[model samples]
Target: MQAVLNAISDPTRRAALALLQGGEECCVCELMTRLNASQSRMSRHMKMLQDAGLVIGRRDAKWVRYRRNRDLAPEFAAVIDAVLAAERPLEEDMA
Candidate 1:
């Protein structure tokens, strides 16, 4: 889907996806800190991923926590897995 592809096209969103890939629910504040992003920027990135059905979020009081959508269609899951796999080396290279 175009939305899914578009969501993953942004490096920031891809990094966010990598964080969520661990299967733990991550809070927006944590993402903000980890990614060195502002609250509004992280929210927009999360919204994009959520709109693509790549992630699901729940309200935790004043914050939203997110995780990868466990029920993704097989095709989308495949794409996400491949992207995350590909991203690992790039991250390591940067580090």
Candidate 2:
């Protein structure tokens, strides 16, 4: 519960998760663009999510793409799904 709460506490992290909900893995550059944040800022939020076991990142040819860490915690998945479902106008995903 604490992990899930902490993971969603930051709007940046929530936006990152929202972007990832589109079913496409996102590279750091893409996230930096989409989130309109500095590389360091994005990386820092990503690290928080990674530490929370909410996201997984993998390197590919100099790019690091991130996606929801499905294998780490099923409970976290349910929590994310529920929150997203209850939230209206899931529009931040486009940004």
Candidate 3:
């Protein structure tokens, strides 16, 4: 799917999604630290995730938290899940 491809096209976005898959909704600050990405760059990636309907972000005062869109396309989610599953390094790094 175009949306799925777009969402995972960037390593940054993939890393973000991979991180999100592990946590209970995370804020921008947390994501920045985990991904070691600049604010602007992370924001752009978040925008793409939102546009793809793969993630949903909500504002909480100064924090903007993001989580996977549970209702998103199953096929797309499956693809991301598969990739994230295959990247054992990503999982190990999270621990």
Candidate 4:
């Protein structure tokens, strides 16, 4: 739970989660482009999210495709849902 909290504490990671919340798999490049982040930075963020079990990544040829972990524990999922809901206004403002 601490790891999950730590992971979502970053705005970048939260934005990434928002993107993945739709259930579509997104490539690292897509995330980088959408977030206006560099490759290395986005990679690190994705690594943290993966380590926290908030997301899963698959090697898609030369890139990694990521999506939210549908298998999350109910507690963790609830936490994510709440955070995303709270962050929605900020997300909309950014968009």
Best by TM-score: 1
Best by lDDT: 4
Which lDDT tens digits does candidate 4 get at residues 1-95? Answer: 89999999999999999999989899989999999999999999999999999999999899889999999999999999999998898768988
Tens-place lDDT digits, model 1, residues 67-93: 999999999999999988988898899
For model 4, name the residue pairs that clash: none
| Per-prediction TM-score | 0.95, 0.83, 0.85, 0.94
Root-mean-square deviation (CA) per prediction:
0.8, 2.9, 2.7, 1.3
Tens-place lDDT per residue, model 3, 18-67, is 87786569887888888999888899899899888988999999888999
Error of 3 at 94 (Å): 14
Candidate 3: residue pairs that collide: none
Better of 1 and 2 by lDDT: 1
* Per-residue accuracy of model 2 over 19-60 as CA lDDT, tens digit each: 888677998789999989999999989988888888889999
lDDT of 4 at 9: 94
Candidate 2 residue spans exceeding 4 A from truth = 90-95
* Candidate 1: segments with Cα more than 4 A from true spot: none
Which regions in candidate 3 have their CA more than 4 angstroms from the true location? 89-95
Which prediction has more favorable lDDT, 2 or 3? 3
Worst 10 residues of 3 by lDDT: 19-28
